[model samples]
Every structure is written in C-alpha cells, then in structure tokens.
Target: MPTSRSSSSIWTYLFLLGEPEQQQRFFKELHFISIVTLSFGVASWLVTVALMQHRHALDTQSASLALVGMVAGVTITALGKSLLAIVVSGSASVLFVTYGFQVLIAATDDPSFWVLPLGVLITLTIAPLFSGIAWYLAVSLCVWVMLGWEQFPAHPQQADQYWPMLAVVVSMLIGLSLNVYFLVLRIHNYQAQRELATMAYTDSLTGLNNRRRFTQSARQLHRSALAPAYFLMIDIDDFKQINDEHGHDVGDEVLRKTAEVIAGIAGEHLCGRLGGEEFAVIYQGDKHGACLLATQLIETVEAAFAGERKVSISIGVAELVKGTDLAHSYRRADASLYLAKKNGKNRYELAAS
Candidate 1:
C-alpha cells in the first residue's frame, strides 16, 4: 500500500507540469522540475549505499540528516509546497555528495576508486542544473568542498586521476550554463506565444473579441445547458453611407465608439465583433432583462455619437430555448435583427419569447 501511494503521489506530481502559466508560474514550473530531480538524486544516493559492503556505511548523524532531508523534500513535494522542499532537498544533495566522497577517499586504493570520480561528476552536474535556485547549489557545493578538501592529493604528481574530475566539472558547467541561457529564451518565446493567441481571438479595429472568440464562448455556454440567456445580433444602421460620405477614418472612430458602448453595456457578458459593422453579444438574462439592456445600448449609442458621428444601432434579441444550440439561437436573433432594420432602424426587435 505504501508503495502504491508513493507511486500515485509521484504520478500526480509529474502530471501537474502540463505547461508554464503566467510569469510567476514559470518559477513554479521550475520548482516542480527541481522536486522531481531531487527525488531521483535521493534515490541514487540510497542505491549507492545499498550497493556497498556495509549497510551502515554512513555515520548515524549524517545518515539521519540525509534521511530527514530526503523524506522532508518528498513530503513537501507531495503537498505541493516549495520553499522548505528547496531547503531540505539542498541539504540532502550536500549529504549525498559529501558522504559519497568520504567513502571514495577511503577506498582510493580499492577497485571502488573507479566509481568515485564518476559520482563527483554526477553530483556537480545535477546540483546546478537548476540554475534559478542557487541556494541549493551553493550549499551543496560548499558542503562538498569543505568536507573533501583534505581528500585532495597533497602533491601534484599524485593528482593524475583528479584532473579528469576537474575536466568533467568544467565541461558540465559550460553545458549547464548554456542550458540556463536557453531556458530564459524559452520563457520569452512562451510570452510571445501568449500574446499571439490573444491577437488571434481579438478584433484589431474595435479591441473586442473576434468572431472566433464569440463562437467558442457561445458554443461552450450552449453546451453547458445554461438557460435564461439571450443572444443579440447588432448591426450599425446606415454604416456604409457614413463610411462613403465621412471617409474611412471617421467610420473607424464611429465603430470604435459603438463597440465601447456595447462592451460597457455587456460587462462580464460575451461581446464580439462578427465582422464589418456587425457584432454579437451573449448575456445571462431573460427576455425582459435583454430588452432593458438592448434599450440602454440603443440610447447610449444614439447619445454617444449624437454631435459628431450621429449614429444609432439596430439590435435583434432572442431568449435561448432549452436544447437549442448557439448557431440556431444566433440565427433566430439575426432574423429579428433584419425585422428591426425593416421597421425603420435604430430600434430592437425581440424574437417570440
């Protein structure tokens, strides 16, 4: 059962790193990755101990410290906590390297000497692979250096095997530094992708949700069985004449102001520009509520563009029927919109309840 629980925890933790969210979320993603690597590092530490001639290879104090760090790191990671996990995991890394190096120093003349340099290289490489969290790497490197200084060869000629270890450290440092640099670049690229996605769903002229966004939101609301809602199709009355007479610039300003009025009226409701001089809105309201909103929208647009542009809106509204999809509801609203235009523009026509 313990094994099963541990496996479940690990898988759950692993799945949480789906994607980097906002800027702060990037740090959380880094923490998650660090947590996973720390777990494997601890596991490697234990595996090395188990492959030894003596089960009690580590001193009682040091062993206790390592176990505390490893277990605490794992527990905090399981709880989705990070700061304490960072601290404990750093300490665990130190103990793993230091204790392993101590054993290596003692067995320098034995066949185990072949494994010592490899262990040191692995420790140095993995510790700083997490570039953003420097405290852990600093603490681990300091512990390893302080504990193993005496283990270094006292004479230059005796340091032949040690040069390869230094070479490994240097190579790993260069490669890890490049990896960190690229990660920063990746974050910037992710930010760009986010901006591009926003642009794709946004109307460039009116700064409103584009048709694509409206379709997505409307479909979602319909599929979720949300009743007591209304869909509205709005068209600017005499828009083509205004553009043809007043020029495109004035026409653009009129569209912008009209969109502002609609957006303000539909606060927290979905409002999107369907295309040139046409828009759509979805609100969680009944026929009466939608009528009130449509009235306010018509009055506000008339008043807003009264002096300069002098424009009004024609709106068609339909209360969503149960089991009707967004496309059907929108089409019903569109039919009403045509009736509104036919009834001498600057007014609203409601679809039969």
Candidate 2:
C-alpha cells in the first residue's frame, strides 16, 4: 500500500496538472491547437478502451493488459500535446493506473487485494497533485470511478454495477464546468489589474504622466550616474484670468493644446502634468541645449496661440548638477520660473548654479 506521503504527493501532482493560464498561453504562443485537437482524439481512445474492458467478459490478465495499453496511450497523448492536453491525458492515465492495480490484485491472491483498494482510496483521498483545484477534482473523480467500478460485483448484467460509471461521468462534468468558470474569472482579473496600473501611471486629461509618475522617474534619474540632465518648470501666464475671461472649457482646451506643444518640444524627454496650468520636463542634455529647447518651447507656444487668443508662458530651466537631488533641482527651477513671471510673462529664465 502507498504511504500517506506518497498518496499526498500523487494528489499534488494531479492538482498542478491543469493551469489554465499556462494552457492558454502555450496554445496561443506556440500555435499548438493541432496538438490540443490530437489530445482530444487520444482521450476518445482511452474512453473506448475503458468501455471495451468493462463490457467484455475478460479475464483479470486481459483486463490488466488492456489497462496498461490505455495508460501508455494516454501518456503518449499527454507528452505529444500541449499543456491542456497533458491535463486531460493525465486524468485518463489516473483512471487506467487505478484499473490496472485492481486487475493485478484480483489476478494474484498474494494478500495484496486489500492493498490495491487501500492505495487507490489513499490516492483519491489526498486530491490531485499540483494541478489547479479544478483539474485535481476532475482527475480525482475519474480515479473514484475506476475504484467504484472495481467494487461492483463481478456478475454480468447487474444494473447496480453501472452506478459507479454514472457517478464518474457526473463528477467529470462538474469539474469541467468549475474549471471554465474559474478560468474566466482569472482572465478578467488579469485584464482589470492591467487597466488599473495604466490608469495609475497615466494622466487622464492630457494623456501624459501624472505628477506621481513624474516624481518617480525624477528620483530614478537622480540615482543614476549619467551625464548632466536638465529640469524645466513651465507655467501658463495669466491662466486664471484667461479662465475667468473665456469659460473654463476654453481654459481646459488651452491646457490640452499647451500639453501638445510641450510634448513636441520635449521629444524623448520625461514630461508630465505637475498641477493646474503647470507642467515639468526632464531631459538628459547640457546647459546650452536645455536653454535652446526651453526657448523653442516658448516660441512655439506663442506662435500657436497668437491671434486666436492672447497666451504666454514663463519657463525656468536648471541643469542637474552633481550632488543635487530631484527636490533640489525642482526648487531651483521653480525659483527661476517665479523670477520669469515677475519680470514679464511669455519669457524664459535659466537658474544660476
């Protein structure tokens, strides 16, 4: 008889046999639909063998041989097919192994007839091994069927002898239904998680990184030992007055249009919404390049908003110096922006080291 540990191990193996995510990915990534189809065919063969042995008045030796053939067929099917194929094939294999053990016990009266049932009972008791809970239940149901059939009296044409077979079929249907339901739930959860992550890191209004994501990237840049980087703080001049004069909707449109201009000027740079009417840009460039970029941004915004509505911006550029953190650079850029606004709107300022 198998010990409790061995029985537990077998159950664990069966449980892990069906991982829906792995099965789906395997079929999709490797284009293994054909293998999956072939596995279904093999399952049909196992079913045929089981029905034949049950109906035929075969001797214990013949039943044992038939069971072995079924096991081999199922194993081959599992090995040749995809992950899902293995799950179904493994279920059939469990059934055949259980039947073979029973036949061997009946053939030899070596005080082991008791052991066979005990072993099967133990295997079923523990549940299927590492397979998903659904697959484990399915395989367990199949094993139970084999055990139940064996227990039936050997008399041919007994109506009660068919109960075990019916029970097995019912159990299999329940397992398959449960597996499909859980698989769908898992996929839905995965998609929801991905969407949530995207929303968390993205700005909904302007389709840029929000303040939170920008700060994270800034911190990452501070930790690196790359060449000097530039930090620019941009604020729309007289933004509140514009909202008061031209409805908030127009103000919102202005913000969106400004974001597009900033994004264009900060090509390949990290740009994000800092707050209302304020934005930030971080780029790896020298002081001169940073100033030129900032100038170009001011010019572009001025030209774009010219004649349609009066618009201007105040930009502050600061080169990230060695030993300076993101907070320090932001402070310097903010100070420069304040100076620019104070001096005049629609102008750019470069912070001194």
Clashes per model (N, Cα, C within 3 A): 0, 16
Report the lDDT tens digits of candidate 1 across residue range 197-305: 8899999999999999989988887777556888889999999999999999999999999999999999998899999999988878777888999999999999997
Best by TM-score: 1
lDDT of 2 by residue, 182-300 (tens): 44454466568668977998888888889999999888886783888889999999999999999999999899999999998898888999989999998787888888888888999
Q: Model 2, residue 35: displacement in angstroms?
A: 27
- Distance (Å) between predicted and true CA of 178, model 2? 2.4
Per-model TM against the reference: 0.69, 0.57
User: What TM-score quantifies how close candidate 1 is to the native fold?
Assistant: 0.69
The alpha-carbon lDDT assigned to residue 67 of candidate 2 equals 60
- Candidates' C-alpha lDDT: 0.69, 0.67
Screening candidate 1 with a backbone cut-off below 3 angstroms (N, C-alpha, C), the clashing residue pairs are: none
